[model samples]
Target: MKVGLGLPISDPPSLLTWARRADAGPFTTMGLLDRIVYDNPEPLITLAAIAAATTRIRVQTEVLLAPLREPVLLAKQCATLDRISGGRLTLGIGVGARPEDYLAVGADYATRGRRVDEMMPVLRRIWSGQPHDDQVGPIGPAPTRVNGPELLFGGFVPAALKRVARWGDGYLSAVPVERTDPLFRMVEKEWGAAGRAGRARLVGQVNVALGPDSVVEDAKQTIGSYYASLAGTYDVHMVTTADQIRTTITGFADLGADEVMLYCWAHDPDQVDRLADLLA
Candidate 1:
């Protein structure tokens, strides 16, 4: 299975460090998460910077909340990032959780699912240089990857899976690392019913913080704080330690994951290096 790292985009100042390290490492992709109401960097802008900082590791929005932004603007930004990265971009889209985030962006949370469905065609048309808003012709410069970056859809529900079958080149499963099988099966079934040929990419994700016991606890606390809204609702293991992380990833790979990205939860930039050590 391929390995990827989720950049702690909140740590903007050290992004270059992480990017260079990622480029120098045994990593397949450097990814970002999307959230409007968080202390995080804008995914596309950060990727543009990383595109300039690194050359080898692919950069991606592990799951950007596409419905929150203006579709045309989103298309341009993604296209530019793809150009800057010389086509090394993977795009994952989803209607995010967190109603407060949609509220912050003035987006209608209730209709985001349908809105995203609408935005897909708009994004594709704009990415292909086709213009809208009464413009004369095509939009900005085309992405290096013909039309745009490869797309993956995130969200585990049946409705979400239907969209995944419709638009995604892959399925970015958001379920916990352990409970991914049922969702992956759903993806396969949907893809087949949609008459899609070839294997759909199965990407698994996990929140992980690795270090000594004390550092581990601190990392777990950080993750807990990040997902506090889900607290007391469901059980989740705040992964810590190299062995645990390895087992988790290997388990996902054994279950047929094409790629697995560990959400590095520790705040320190050194955590990147530590993760490299473990994987090495």
Candidate 2:
């Protein structure tokens, strides 16, 4: 399976440095996460910068909160970014988990799932150069690819999984194999039921913090604080050792993952070479 490196969004100033290092490393793609309520930079804008800075690796949103943005404008931004990146963009989307993020944007948190379902088609329509109803012109600056960028659907709900067959190009799982195995199977089953040819591309995620004890401890605390306010107990698997990383990647490959992103939580750029040497 291919391996991607997820850059840390906590430190915005060092992002390009990390991107530059990752671009020269043994990584296929670079990923970023989204959160409006958090201190992290916006995924799309940051990814645009990363795409411009790097020539080899792809830039992706690990999971952009789709229901929070305006569909037509988002379509335009995505199309522009896709072209700017020379078609090296993958838009992973989901109806987010944090109610605070929705509330901050004045989006109806209760209706997010429905909003995302409605938004997907509108995004495609805009990307196809179709004029909005009663408007004289269509959205300008077409995408690099025929129908905009590749879309990977994220989230653990049944409706979320169904979206893979309905509109997405694949599934993005943020959990480990023990939890993600059945979900991937369900997505494949839905793909077949929906008469989609071939199989759904399955991408997996693993949170990591590979470095000295101080860095690993800081990452654990940061992760805990960031996720402390959620409804239930938030338990994320953060593989710290090189052995753990190897074993985790192997496990995902066994589960038939197309690509597995190492979602590095440590803000240190040195972590890039650390992982590169291990993967090499």
Candidate 3:
């Protein structure tokens, strides 16, 4: 199983530092969380910077809110980033959970899932160097990969699983394997049913922060605040010690995860090295 590190987007300035550290470490990918209304940096743009700074680590949006932006524009941005990253971009997308994120963009919250269904094919079409609108020319800067960046879909719903089989290269899970294992099986069933050759990739994400007392406490506070709105509805999944991190990775690997992204909630760049040392 491969291990990946999630960027601390809460501290924008630390992104490049962390990315470079991850690149120099055993980490295979550097992931980012996405949101429109939050104080965090935009995933794609921040990832572009991270790509420029790091050579080996793949840059990914652990899950970008796909319905918030125009599909054509999103395709262009992702294609451009894929080129900038030397084909090391994984486009993880989903219909986001927060209504405020959609409301801020004037997007319809209720129709997001349906919109995502409609948009996936269009994104593929654009990436195929096909003109999104026949009236306009084909989008330029074609993706490094034949079909665009490897797409990973997120969400626990049946519709989300269907999207993985229909349009994505994999499934990205934020939930634990107890919940995700069944979903992965369903994805495989759907993938085979769809006649997609081979199996869909299974990616997992866990929030982690390892450092001094202050750093761990800070991570707890930051994460708590981020999920404040969802309070009772959301459960914060964070591990603050090296033992927990190792255990989490082993558990996911045993569960058949292709890659596990360790989401760093604290904004300390040195946390990258700390994680690397622990992993080493």
Candidate 4:
């Protein structure tokens, strides 16, 4: 399976350093987490910088909050980044959970999902340049890829699976092992019914913390706690030793995960190197 690294959006200095390291590492792709009016920097902008710095590593928004922005504008931005990245951009999007974020951005939280559904088509239309209201031809100079960047939708529930089946190139699973199997089956069924079976990518998000004398309980207190809050619910968080990391990844590969993005809790540069070594 292809492995990717997630940058720490909470720290700008470390984010840049990690981006460079990930580009040079064995990781097939590098991803940035998204949030607005949060602690992190803007994902697209940071990705643009990484694109300029690296030559081949695919850059992705692990998941961008789509309902908060104008679809056309976001399309333009993503297209521009894809061009700059030489077609290495994968746009992962989802409806954000924070109601305060939507309210702050003057977007209605209640209707964000509906807005996302509508926005997907508009974004595609803009990218394809099929001609729409008040615009002539397709948007230019167009993305580096003819079809524009790959769109990956993220969420763990049935509604999210349905959305992926309806309008996405893949589904991003960000839950624990128990939940993932069911969601993966749901995606497989839905994709087959949609005639997109075996065509859609399946990416699993796993939290990682590896070292000697490091117990699962330690990971639970640190990484697990953070992800639980982010996921907005308490669920099993996969905490394992360095050896177990490889085993878990293999299991996910067996489960049909095309790729696995590691959300590392240790922000130290050394931890990045250590994780790379363990994965290698």
Model 4 agreement with the true structure over 1-280: per-residue lDDT tens digits: 8998777554577776887788888898888877775666789999999888888899999899999898878989999999889899999998877777787889999998889888988887777766646645666658876566998998866777888888888988888654688888898889888886456788988777665444334555645444444575545566556766777788789889999888765555565687788876
In the range 151-227, model 1's lDDT, one tens digit per residue, is 99988678888887787788887667778998888888899999998878899988777667765676677667767
- Cα RMSD to native, each candidate? 1.8, 1.1, 1.1, 2.7
Q: Which one wins by TM-score: 1 or 4?
A: 1
How many residue pairs in model 3 have overlapping backbones? 0
Worst 10 residues of 1 by lDDT: 230-239
Query: On residues 12-130, what C-alpha lDDT tens digit does candidate 3 reach at each position?
Result: 98788888888999899998888988889999999999999988789998889999999888999999999988999999998878999998989999999999999988888889988
Clashes of each: 1, 0, 0, 1
CA-lDDT, candidates in order: 0.82, 0.89, 0.89, 0.78
In candidate 1, which residue pairs clash?
Answer: 129-138
Candidate 3 Cα outliers beyond 4 Å, as residue runs: none
lDDT head-to-head 2 vs 4, winner? 2
Position 147, candidate 1: lDDT: 60
**How would you encode candidate 2's per-residue C-alpha lDDT over 1-280 as one tens digit per residue?**
7999988766899999999999998899999988999888999999999999999899999899999999988999999999999999999998877899999989999999999999988888878888766855788678887677999999888999999999989999997767889999999999999999888999999999999998798788877777878727555778999999999999999989999999987789999999999998
